[model samples]
Each structure stands twice: as structure tokens, then as C-alpha cells.
Target: MTTLTLRGLRTASRFQRVQPHPLLGLQSQFLVPQTPSFRYASTTSALPTRTPRTFPVNGPSTTLPAPLNVPARGENQSLVPYLYSVGKSYLAFYKTGVWNIYTNFKLSREVQRKIDAQNASTFSAAVVSASLTRSDLQLLVRNWHDIKRVPMFALVLLICGEFTPLVVIAISSIVPWTCRIPKQVESDRRKLEQRRSASFRELTTEPPTEAGVEKLAKTQLMHINKSLGLSFGMWDWVGGLPTGILRRKVSRRVEYLELDDGLIRKAGGIQHMELEEVKMALVERGVDVLSKGEAQLKGHLNAWLLSREKAPVEKLLLTRPSVWPVRMNAPEKV
Candidate 1:
């Protein structure tokens, strides 16, 4: 077993002694200790300050915590360095993903389900316990999605050769999350904005009344489903979405939004939200923020939060309630 001690891993030959990874630094807190003995002292700093962790790797079979997602390469960076840097990052990201899945493969369905349920806790508790931010978990899942697209990337590299970047630029959606250029992100956002623009119009039509269900319930529901990027199962274009499926999908989406709202609030509310986060939240709510400045985005998000956080219950209703207002599936707040 190779044990890596974070505090004093100055040198290692063939990983024979404790050492920092070539790619990962000593300060990387993304990989939490698997052993119960090495628990987080605080979410702000997941690793214990005084004690050193012994990160054991049992060949390639070992599963460590997932790596941090590759952050977007800076805009000023030339294309060559951008490609080179992300290539290394993706290699590390992919290896850890395979190892992670391999370790999980041994679990029984019940155990797996329980683990998953535990993982689905409100961010207030989960951020401290799991040592992973909500975005980290999302990126971790996205990495798995990218794993399946390996063949597609390999094919492009083979056929296009030196022109692979051009091919990738053309088909940017298929590019891995870690490897997406700024152009691709803008392209993807523009596409999502189109759908969100339509859905946002429908979602905000009636202003989430407390008295009863809004008008044109089915049409609004379809738009809600579209905004969430939900799968339209058991419905045809002629019949539109079935009421049963529509209610379930919208409810599930609200539940997820509830979780996200708590996470953002816990992360110190809209004022503390970074520029990228502000953009993302606005876009999700169906605002076109392509040309908006950071200050303007925050103002919009603040307004969104006030309306969303205060009246979550009314927004959750899918049908005319016998009662005046519906109960919200509230997430635990910090």
C-alpha cells in the first residue's frame, strides 16, 4: 500500500514514499480521506490541520475521492497551451473516474441505494460531511458522462489529426466538460438560452399565486419541463405531455431547485455568488445574461431569490389545492 502524507511529501521515487502527485499539489482538499479516522474538522478546510492523512492506493483498484473538475482555461491563453493543460487534467480525471466506478461495482443494490440516498442530503449537512461542494459532485457526474464519449474524441483525433481543434470547435457539445473552450461554453449557453427564454416566459406568466393553480396549467407545465431539460417519456407530440408525468417531472424539478436554493443561501446568498455562478443561476431561471455585467447579474439573482425563497410553497403547486397553499418540500438550512 502506498501512503501519501499531505504535510511532508517532499520527494518520492516511483511513489515508494509519501509524495504529492505530479499534477495535484499538497493543498488539494478535493480528495477526502476514505478511512473513518481521517475525518474533516470543518467544511471550510476538509482535511485536518494538525494530522496528516495516509492515502493508501492498492494498485489501480483503489478508489480515492474524485478529482476536482478541470476549471476553464483562461481566455488569454493560446490554444496550444489550453489543449496541452486540459489533456493532462483530463487524463487524471478519467483515471480516477474508472477507479471510482470499479470500487462502487462491488456494492449490493440496497447498499448502493443507501449510499446514494445519503449522498442526496441537503447541502448544509452534506458540504460538511461529504467534503464536496455541490458543483464538485455535478462535475464528478459529468466526468462519467464524458467517459462514454472517449470513442468520439478518439475518432476526431484520428480523422482530423492537426485539425482536431477545428472539428471540436464545430461539434463543441460533445467536448468533455474539462476541455470545453470559452467559445463552446458561449455556444452551449446560447442554445440553452433559446429554450430557457421560452420556458421562462411560461413559468413567470401567472407569478406563482398562493390561491390555486395557475392558468393554462398543462402548457405552463410543458414549458416547465422543457426549462428543466427533463426527458419527455410516455408522451407524444399530438397528446402533449400526460398530466401524471408532467406533475411528477415538475415536482421533481422543484425539489431539485429547492436543494439548490438552500445551497446558494448557505453559501452566503446572492451577494456572495461569483460572476460565473450568477450567470448560471440566471440562465437556469431563463434570463438571457450574455451581455449583462456582473453587477447586473447579481441584482437579477437577488430579485429571483427574494421571490423564490419567500414563496416556495405556492410555486410547488401543480394542481388546484383544496387548501389555500401547498406544503413545500423544504431542505434543511444551515
Candidate 2:
């Protein structure tokens, strides 16, 4: 019986050990269903956070921004002494009648002394003289006839008449009329008629170039001898256009000019042109000769004439072709 009990106990222990191994194998199979074949990896590295620079709550920083490098106003350089001398001379001419009164003022010694004295930073004489000259407002008024061609009231009245005709008539009835000579009135009337009738005839009888000179000469009310002079002897010509109507008439004639110095016999013996024609030809040729790609040739021509420096017509054409037409409409300031 003792032997049987020992064998039974050995068998039970063996069975228990085998049973635990089978259960452990089953547990591992169940756990295998929960496990993943591929592990996930993070794509991005961790980034560090930064603190922004902050200003003090009390006040702004003493150091200026990069752009604020200009000098203070009081630190600027002083004006030149010769400039001050010029100012003194201009002041003397304008004020005190000193320039005219002191005839000896032009002498070198007196002039130099005044100029030197005037140049000082706090020159008392200059300051006093300038202040006094500026303050003396009475000297500013002058005789209108001495310098101005027409009275200020006449110009004002003319403008006023155009703008307010009723006011002009009312004022005219109150003021006494100044009588001008009938001959003078007739002369002015003839001049006005000539200006209004200054139309460009197609010159069926003669070319505009030829007819323009004769017409311009005959149209002049003031008789000027052709043999004695190259230019017309009109005082109005020297003084330039007197009225807007006259100016427009002159501009219209100038626009149609196409003649050269010689005779231009147009088709069917219609007209003949002469010297004014030649001048016109020069002006037209001047457009071709003076112009570049896109620029007005006349301005270039004038600039060349004034400065004697070459301006590029070729490069101008290449750069700006649209400005070429501007030459025709340009104002004749010269």
C-alpha cells in the first residue's frame, strides 16, 4: 500500500506540471490577438518655445531706431557772407532810396566796408536798416504810369466787365469818359478787323508762303517800309499779343504754316508761297531733324540751341514714341 501511494502521488505531481504548461500556451495565444505587428513612430521632432522681447512699462528705450540719424536743427552751418552782402544790396535798392541817394555808394571802399559790416552775425546796422526798410510801407507805393503800361483799374475794369457786365455799365455811367482821338479809335478798329479776318486762304491765286508775307505786311496798320527793315515795325509786335483774340489769330496762322524760303507752286497754279513759307519749312523740317523715337523734336532743338549740347533723337524714339505729337501743341514760351 505504501508503494501504491508513492506512485499515485508522483503521477498527480506530473499531471499538475503538464496541465500548467498547456494553460500557459493557451494564454499566450489569446494575448497574441491584442498585439500589433508594426509599431507607430512619431514623424516630428519636439520644438522649443521662445519668449518675446518686451519693453519696460515705465518708459521707452534711450537708444534711437536705426533710421533716426539726422542732425539737430540748431547745429546747421551758417549762411555765407557774400549772400548777406547781396541781400544788403537788394535791400538798399528796394528801400531808403539809399542806392539812388548815395551816388558814391558804388565806390569800392564804401561798398566793401558796408558788405563786411553787414556780414556779421549780429550786425546792428544791417538789422536796423532791414527792419526799417521792411517797416516803411509808404515807400512801397509808386506811380502806376512809371512802370505799368496800363492802369490797374483799367485791367480790373476790363476783367470785371467780362465777368460782371451790369457792374461795369453801372460803374461806367458814374465815371467820366476819357475821349480818345477818332484816328486812334479808327486805327484800333482796323487792327481788330485785320486780326479777325486773318484766315488762311488756300491761295488759289498764289501759294500761302508767298501770300503770307504780303498779307502779313499789308495787314499791318502801322506802315513799315519793306526795303528798310527785315522785321515788321509794329510796337505791338515788340510788346507781344495785346489781347487773347489777337493771340488766338496769330496761333491759328502759325499752325497752318507749311512753306519754305522759296516759291511753292501748289497744284493747278492755285497759289504761290515765299519767305514765311521758308520759315515754316524750317520749322517742319526741324520736327524731323530734331525729333527722336517718341519725343517732341522742337524742345530738343531748343535745348540744343540754348545749351549747344547734343540730345538723342534715336534713343528718344526708341524709349517714348507717344510724345512726338506734343511738339505741335506746345506753347511758344520763347
Candidate 3:
């Protein structure tokens, strides 16, 4: 047995010498130092990265141009479609000029109604005179002559400034006499004038009270705003206008040689006037000084003026009504 064991050990030793030990078999390839396969294993450092690009979104997703209804540029575009584009919107139109016909016509009607209702017995003489160009008046005279006024009645009118002859003749000839002034149009012309003068006294001559002026201002502002496409708490039109006639179209008492440049410049550039300022100017210009709310309006106005230290009004006061007719005390007295 000892001989057999010795022979086996010698055989194993020969086998080990021929090959490597089993424990080193796995690392045998490493001992040979085989080159790394570039195909399977990359040694290059990782790249600094970013997300991949994406395509832009498709149709109608684009933003719309401002003042949407404005005509798109090009030959095919619609003609200056809205007042907004031209900045001729209702508020700008009416608050500025004859636009009141478009904007404040209803309000004027309401105010007139209120006046008529309040002064049912008063005779109102609204003497609105339009200066006629010589050529136009001549044309009108020619037209009148062609209409065949009775010679006697025309003579009477020319001599006495008597409209009665014209009225009577027109009443007789008219298909319906719709345009003729009403005969016996009950009026207290003197009384209304007195009242108007009184109202003015109550407002201007007296110490300030907010009742008259404020009411006038508020009502006028409300109407003007509504006419111009705005209202209380609504100033949306300030930014721009939408499609349509921006203001009610009306014939203006005032004349202008041109629409875009002539009168607009004289009235103060539309761009230069803010909406509130426009309202104030309109009320100040159009309204009669004797309206009922003038006292109240004058009060606030006086306060504002006094606050601003406007000229001619050294100081203002709001004395109680018991002072019989209201009066203003000097600032020193106050």
C-alpha cells in the first residue's frame, strides 16, 4: 500500500507540473493578460447630458393680436372695422364731441323729461342758434322761396320777427304739421328763467354744499359713461373697444372741417384726455347752470376747488341752510 500511495502522489505531482493547480484555474486567463474587448466593454467617460428636443405645438395655439377686431393688415383685410381701432369708440366719441348725440341722447332726453316733469308750468325757450355760412343760408333762402311762402305772411315775419305767421301758414299747409311749434305751448318763460337764476344763486353765490353739484356730476357721468359704452364700476373700454359702431351716430351742433384732425385737435387730443376728465369736461360744457342738482354739485365742486386752492375762490365754506340764503365766510373767519 505504501508503494501504491507514493506512486499516486508522484503521478499527481507530474500532472500538477504539466498543468496549473485547480485553485489558480479561474485566474489563469488573467496571468496570460488578455486584452479587454472594446466591442463589449467601453472605457470612455459618461457624457454630460440634456433632454432631447420636442416639436412645437400645432395650430390655433398661437396668441391673438391685441384689439382683436382691428382689420388685419393686407389688401383683403376688412376696412377699419371698429371705433376702437381708430380710437373713435363711444366713450371717446361722445365724451369728447358731438358724440353726445350718439352717447348722451337718451340721457339728455331723460334730463329734459325730468325738467319738464318738475317744471310743468314753466315756459322754456331754448334759443340754439347755428351760424350759417353765407352760401348755405342763401341756398336755404332759395329753397324757402321755391316752397312758396305767402308774400304777406313772409313780409309780416320779416318786419316784426313774428313766427306766428309762419306757424299758422305751415299748420294749414303741412301734411301732418309735425314740425310746427305747438300753439299755446304752456310755458312760464319768465318763471323758469327766474328759477334758473335762483338755482345758480343757490349754487355759485352761496357757500358750497355737495347736494347739487354731486348729483349733477354723478347723473351726467352715468349717462355719459353709458352712452360711451361704460358704466359705474365699468372702465373696461379704457383698454380698447370691440367690433361695431363705438358710439351712437348723431348730427353735431358744433362744426368741424375734418373728422380725424381738425376738430379733434382743437377739442384736446383724444389721446391726451382720460375717461374721467372727459366726463367732467362734457358736463361742464353741455349742462345749464340752473339744473336742480347744481347746488349739490357746486358744493362738492367748491370743496374740490378750495382743496386745490383754485384762483378766485380764496376760501370755501359749507354753512348750514339756516343762514337763510347760504353765504361763504373768509378763510380767516373760519
lDDT of each: 0.45, 0.23, 0.24
Stretch of 10 with least lDDT, candidate 2: 57-66
What value does the lDDT take at residue 268 in candidate 3? 30
Q: Write the per-residue lDDT of candidate 3 for residues 53-115, one digit (tens) a residue.
A: 111110000010011121235566465554233333212211121211111122222223433
Least accurate stretch of 10 residues (summed lDDT) in model 3?
57-66
Q: Return the candidate ranking by TM-score, descending.
A: 1, 3, 2
lDDT of 2 by residue, 93-192 (tens): 2221211111111121222234245544222233244421111110111111111212333454345432322343323322111111123323433443
TM-score of each: 0.50, 0.15, 0.16
Which candidate has the top score in TM-score? 1
- Please give the ranking of all candidate structures by lDDT, highest first, separated by commas: 1, 3, 2
> Per-candidate RMSD vs. true structure?
13.1, 46.4, 42.1
Candidate 3 ranges with C-alpha deviation above 4 Å: 1-69, 72-103, 119-275, 278-304, 308-334
lDDT score of residue 20 within candidate 3: 27
Return whichever of 2 and 3 wins on lDDT. 3
Candidate 1 stretches greater than 4 Å from native? 1-28, 31-132, 135-137, 140-158, 168-172, 198-207, 210-216, 228-249, 313-334
Which regions of candidate 2 fall more than 4 Å away from where they truly are?
1-149, 152-198, 202-334
